[model samples]
Structures are given as C-alpha cells and as structure tokens.
Target chain A: MKRLVVMALVGLGLALGIAAADTPTTIRRDGVVLTIPQEKRAEVIGDRLRCLVCQNETVENSQAGLAKQFRGIIRRRVVKGETNQQIIDFMVHRYGIFVLLKPPLIPLTWLLWFSPAIALALGLLVLLLARRRRQQGPPPLSPDEHDRLKELLS
Target chain B: MATMLTRRLMFGLPLVAVAAGGVASYALLERMGRGTYNPQAFNNPLVGHKVPDFSLPGHDGHAGFDQAAIMAQKRPLLVNFFASWCVPCVEEAPYLDAIAKSGLDIWGIAYQDKAAALDLYLAKNGDPYRRLASDAEGRVAINWGVYGVPESFLIAPGGEVRWHTAGPLFPEIIEDQLKPALQRLT
Candidate 1:
C-alpha cells in the first residue's frame, strides 16, 4: 500500500513537471538520505539525529566515523521492524535530548516555544486598549473644567 | 501617576531582563575561564541508569569483562574508554594511573584499536585498568553514550552509571569531580 502511494506521488510529480530523474523514489537528491529500499525509514530517523562529532550536520549528512556507526545501528533497527518512535527514543536514551536536531517541546522549553505568541498577544491587547480609549474620545469634562474651557475660547 | 507608572514599567522590565541576561553570561564565562565547565558538552542520559547489555572479546593482554562483571562489582569503579589513536587518551594516562593507584578499580574498553597498537600504547603509557575489553565495532561505546575517546564513567556498585566526563581527565577534574563523586559513594 505504501509503495502504491509512493508510486502515485511519483506519477503525480512527473505529470506536474518534475523530471523523472529528479524524483525521490528513483534518484537521490543532494542532501537526501541514501535511497536503499530498506533504508528509507532508517534514513528519515537518522536525519533527525545530530552527528556528535560534526555538531551541525545531521547523522545522514556527516561523514564522521561515529555517524557511520549510527547509520549502521539505525539501519539494523529499521530492518528489524522497530517503529520510528522506538528508534528515536533509543538514541535519546543513550545520548540525551541534545542528540535531537530539532528540540522537542517540554516543560523546560515552554517559554522558548511560546514566547513569540505570548508577545503577539500582549501587543494586540495593548493596541485594543489604546483603540478603545480613542473611540471613547475625551472623558466628559467636569462642570468647572467645561466652563473654564468655554471662557478661554470666547 | 498612571503615566509615571507606565513609564517606569516600560523602562524597568527591559532593564531587569538585560541585567539578568548579563549576569548569566558573566557567570558562564567565568566558569569557562576557570576550566570548571565545558560549553560543548551535554549531559549523558545514561547517568543514573543501569549499564545496558554488551559483550566484547578480550584485547591486549587483559581478559574481557562484560555486563555481568559490571553487575558483580561490589564497589565503585571507572569504565574508561580510550583508543590507541586518540590523542586525548594519551594525555589522560597519568590521571587513570592515579585513580588506579588510589585502589579504585578501573575497567578499560579499547575502542576500535588493534592488539599490537593496544599493547604498545599500554606498555609505553601505563596500564591502569584491572580488567579490559574491546569495542571493535563501537556498538558498546554507543550504548554507553560515549561521544569520544578518553571519556570516563564512574559507575556505582551493581552497574549504575553515576557520572561521566567527555575529555582528557586532568588533575583538577580528578580532584574536584571524580574524587568527590567516589567519596560520596563510600
């Protein structure tokens, strides 16, 4: 079924204007993980893991010795039919959450994750209050203040 | 009064945030300068967890030890990962020797090294490990969360990983972190 869907997508891409050679199913693109039949799942999982030695490169892109070992382990697990979650969890268990290329949302990262939205909300609130004040115009002047203003205008 | 309060708050909040950020940066810089912290290192998740299953063939002149051996240990010990080709491991030799001389057991795992190189490296530097093994495929090292050679783990009795360091263990580290950690176990 998955193969059928992938085949459909490839057909759709070819119809839409993507070259046959550029399609992911048939040919590997630059920075795309290796395209072996059994390695697709392993490649996806490895793409999210950081290469410790290279630091910036994902395990899929790094040429480091350790990255090669990671590729081996991930391929073995995927071939064994382990779920993607299990593979990612195993890496995290050994290497800590830092091994993840993209940080997961957790209690510690709550502020980091939500701060932009929080700031936007605060700005909209301030704008709403200011507009409300403007719509209300100036407060009704006290009798003495109204008389003084009238005398000054006359 | 309302305007004054608003003005004070507009100035005060950002000032407070900037001050807090400044203080944090200053403290981190000071610790880095003092050699008490490494910015590039992350906490190994295996700490406080049991050592996972692994077995490796014997290497060099020492017999191999496995997870069963680690579980049978009745006292705190060190699992030192070193490679014959790793420069930092050569730098860490004296510290390992010191730890061994202090009567604490050390189990060394040779990472991806040949027998002749291992024999030469140990003989020339000094053999501090009481028992030894080899992780020729690096599978065991990966399980142990070792990112690099010269990393050391302080394991508690029955194989609980207590602490780990990921560089050459200098004298200061041995005295400040490793010794205190061992003392706490005893």
Candidate 2:
C-alpha cells in the first residue's frame, strides 16, 4: 500500500513538472499589456530610471500610471533601435540631472563622487588619532597627585 | 590643568558637534513644517530652453494648441499640465481664471484623465483655458519633464520656457510671481 501511494505521488509530480516545463516563460509584468514582455529589451534603459511618483521604485518595477507610460515610451524607443545612452540622454534633456538613478560625474557632483574617499580619509585620521592617544599612554600624574596616589595605595 | 583642558576638549567637541547637528536638524525640520523648505523640488532644466515640439489632440470642445501656436503668440503664455485626478489642480483652477482675467493666455493639458471626469471637474471648478489638449498617455508631459500635476511653464513670446512652477498656482503666486515675471520679460 505504501509503495502504491509513493508511485501515485511520483506520477502526479512528474505530470505537473512536465506541464510547467512546456508552458512559455515570457509574460508582461505589473502594467499595461504590450507586444513584448515587460522584462525584455526596454528594461536595459528602464532599469536605470527612477519612477518619480513612487519615489523608491524604478520605472520598470513601479506600478504607477506614470511609470507605465514611461515604460511604453522606452519600449517604443527600443523598438526604434535607439541606443541606451541616446534614450537616457533624451530623458536627461527633459527631466534634468535628477532623473538619473546613478548620478553622473559633473562639477556640481564632485563632493558626491568623492564621498567614499573622504569618509575613508576621515576614518584613517580618527584611527591615527586613536593610535597616537594609545601610544601616549595616560597623562603623567602631578608630583602632589602621585604622592596622594601612593598614600592611598599604601 | 593641561590634561583637564584636553579631556574637556575631547568630550566637549563631540558634544558640540551633536548639539550643532541637532540644532541644524531642528531648523531644517521647522522650515519643512512651515512649507518653506522642500527637498523634492529640483530646478527644471527646460527653463531657458525652447519648448519641445508636440501636437496633442483637442479634447472636449476646446482647441488644442501646439508649438506653432505658442510661437505665434504675441504675449507670454502659461502652459499648465493639470488633471482631474490631481487635488492641487482643483486648488489651482480659480487662480488660472484670475490669470486669464489678467490677460495672460493659458493653455491646458489634461494629463492621464478621462474626458467624462475632466468635464465634470472643470464644470464644478472652472475652465479658463484658451485651448485644451489631452495627454492620454502622458507622453507630452514627459517630453516637457513635468514631475507632477498642476505644473506651470511660462513661455516667453519668442518660445523659450521662461519660468516653471511644479505646484499649484495660488492667487499670491500669480500676483507676486507671474505678473512680475511677465512684466520683466515683456
């Protein structure tokens, strides 16, 4: 009886697995229906843009109406064979530098670009100060204080 | 005495830094609460650039104006991106009427709204736009780099985007901001 049950379960699993394997993996996600699936070519550029409405999510990941429209724009552009840089530049031309998820290196962004290095230098400075303090040992006691300390110890 | 001074300096410096940070945070939060400081607001790059070419279909009974229409205007035109679904746009409706009364041509773009709902919204609030267009897909809004609804762009007679505001237009904004700006440009 146990062997019969085990065989039935294995048969069911195999049937389900075969069905799953036969089904197509391609499909749209989150938004309006399009000819191409949501996770396709357009996402090459879409992945870089932030959805302004939802703030945290990328345009590809966001379900907001504006994000959907943005996706449509990107999909059409991608279909027209535009380069990723060209598409990104088009967005930048309209939305300004803030639209980029990864900010570009410009004169205004020098501080941002070098923040990690600045932080590392600050960390090193602190470590150096701490090491010097450790090396310096405790401050030398005054003669009167040393005498008082000896008396207390005795 | 020297050791005591150095010890005091070590502790006092961090305490001073913390206190300064707290005070700065308080001031910034106060400004935010008073609506004077907004971190989300960024400068529109389109300002001082010519208006991008776009032609949207006319919605309702109003005529849709394009880049050519704006170039032909002899006066400064306010291109307002609004939608019925946006709450701020409702607040801005009356102020738009006031601006129209003051003799500035106002062009309206309905961003991602249904015609039925938009008609109802305008009927209840007011419609002072000289021409109205529908941006059903929000393509044109993206082209204009509009971040949100109730955004206004003041286009100079020569077709440059002179000024832009990303929020509702209040009476004070029109009286103090737009009028002075128009006066300066014209």
Candidate 3:
C-alpha cells in the first residue's frame, strides 16, 4: 500500500508538471516564431477581431480553422511592419465592422452602450420618489379624524 | 386634495411602469426576431473594395490563374469559391452553368480541394467556369474573405467586388440579385 501511494503521488506530480510546461505563453504556427512587441501587435489585433464563423468568440480564442488562418494573416501583416491601425483597417475592409469583437461606439451602437445605465438611473429615480412618498407618512390624519380616534379609545 | 393627488400618483406610476415595460419588451422581441447582430445580415465589406491580388494553379486544362489578366479583360466577372465536398456547391452548379451559358464570365476557385476531386466535380456538374483555379491551401479564398464554400462574388469591370452571396445560388437569386447586378455592371 505504501509503494502504491508513492507511485500515485509521483504520477500526479508528473502530470501537473507536464500540464504547466505545456501552457502556451506565446502563439506559434509550424515552427514560426510569433514574437512580440512585433508579434504581440498581431496578438492584440487577433483579440480585438471576432472569428467570422465562430460568431461569439474572438479570433484569438476560437479553435475554428478560419480563425487560425486569420491569425496567420495578422502575423504576416505584423512581420511586414504594418501599424496596428492598418492591420485592423485591413481586416475591417475584408470582413466589415461586425468582425470587430467590440463594435465601435457609432450612432447605431450608442443605445447599446448607454441603455443599461439609463435603465438603472430610471429605476433609482422611481425608487427615490417612492421612498420619499412613504417617508412623508400618510398626510397627518385630519383633526376631525383625530377626535374620532380619541372618542373611540375612551 | 393631497391624499387624492397621492392616490392618483400611486396608481398612475404603476400603470405607466407596466405600459412602458410592455412597450420595451415588445420592441426587444421584435429586434431579436430581426436578428440585430446577425452575422449573415452583415454586408460584405469587400463589396466596394478591389478584389485582392491572387495567383493559383489552374485546373481542367486551363492556364495558370492570374488576377491582372482577369481584370485586364474589363468585363464583369463572377468569382465563386467552392469545394467538391460542399453540398451547396453541387446544388448551385447548374445555376452557375446557366449563368455561364448566358454569356456571364464565371470563374471557380476550388477551395482546399485536390485537383482530381475538382476534375471529377467539374465533370459531374458540367463545368460552368471559363477557367477553374485550384486553391489547394485556401490562401486565395481567405484573401477574398471566404469562410464558407459556395460563396460567390460579383466583380465589376474595374475588378471591384460589387456584390456577394454566401449560400447556394438558387434560380431566384440568379434572376433577382445577380441579374440586376449584371445589368448595372453593363
């Protein structure tokens, strides 16, 4: 039993060690070194762009083959010394603003960005008005009603 | 009077809240039904842009594909990306053939397909393409922003992408969309 426990512990430790070593710190493809600040520019671009096929996921997180190809395109642009904006423009030109993970805050999207805050503000206003009305306590009972209350108590 | 006002407000506030909520929910449902963020509805950004430069190996006994040569012809062209395995490509092949017969220049980029498979596909579907190129690695298709097979782009005389569709080309699409665009191009 002692030997078995030792072997199990050794196996667990080795598995964890391997997993840690395998954690990717940088992206690579087919032995090409995608390093930054040069390659990091591409990484930033990838994170900002959405995968056309995956819909919900950014190109960086998507496992779709199209996403991988998009990343390759970004890397190539980065290697060619394209500026971040130029690279983004190229992608937007090819795939439209929808390809951007965060749609730009244009007139069309203003409501999307502000509606939550607007709703919260409206709720708070309603709550404050309701609380104020409650705090005022029902308008003090009229004098006649007070006399009637005294008479009933007697 | 104050009590009456307070009572009116109490009832009015809830009534207004419920009405507003109903209106808001209805609007939201309508928007959702319309697919506000639908990727399919998004316009192809390349529509107004020039077709990306590309060169690929030609299949079916055609000469090698060249972008400059195609643009030099100064005629409207249809560039279709397809693969042997894509079902929609098979469905749309006859329509493409019909359009080709109608004197429209249609070219095919066999996306990530082997030459043998492409030859077989063309043989089976009655080759509609004036020239077919093999995009074995799919690099050229990527340049054209093709994420799916059976996507077709209509290039204007100046080599600008004027319109695009992302699915099987049915007769209605050919008659309505492609025909109108072709008419405009001419």
Identify the leading candidate in terms of DockQ. 1
Docking class of 3: medium
Q: How accurate is candidate 2 locally (lDDT)?
A: 0.85
Error of 3 at A89 (Å): 2.7
Write one digit per residue (lDDT tens) for candidate 3, span A5-32.
9999999999999999987766676234
Q: Per-residue lDDT of B80-125 in model 2, one digit per residue for the tens?
A: 9999999988877888898888889899999988999999998999
**Shift of residue A83 alpha carbon in model 3, Å:** 4.1
What DockQ do you compute for every candidate structure?
A: 0.69, 0.67, 0.57
Positional deviation of residue B147's Cα in model 2 after best superposition, in angstroms: 3.0
Clashes of 2: 0
Off by over 4 Å in 1: A1-35, A129-154, B1-9
The A-chain TM-scores of all the candidates are 0.61, 0.66, 0.67
- Candidate 2: CAPRI quality band: medium
User: Which residue pairs collide in model 1, if any?
Assistant: none
Clashing residue pairs found in predicted model 3: none
lDDT per residue for candidate 3 within B1-186, as digits (tens), equals 987998999899999999999998888777555433223556777788887888988885976577786677678999889999889899888888888989988888888888788778888988888888889887788777777888999998868888898877778777778889889888
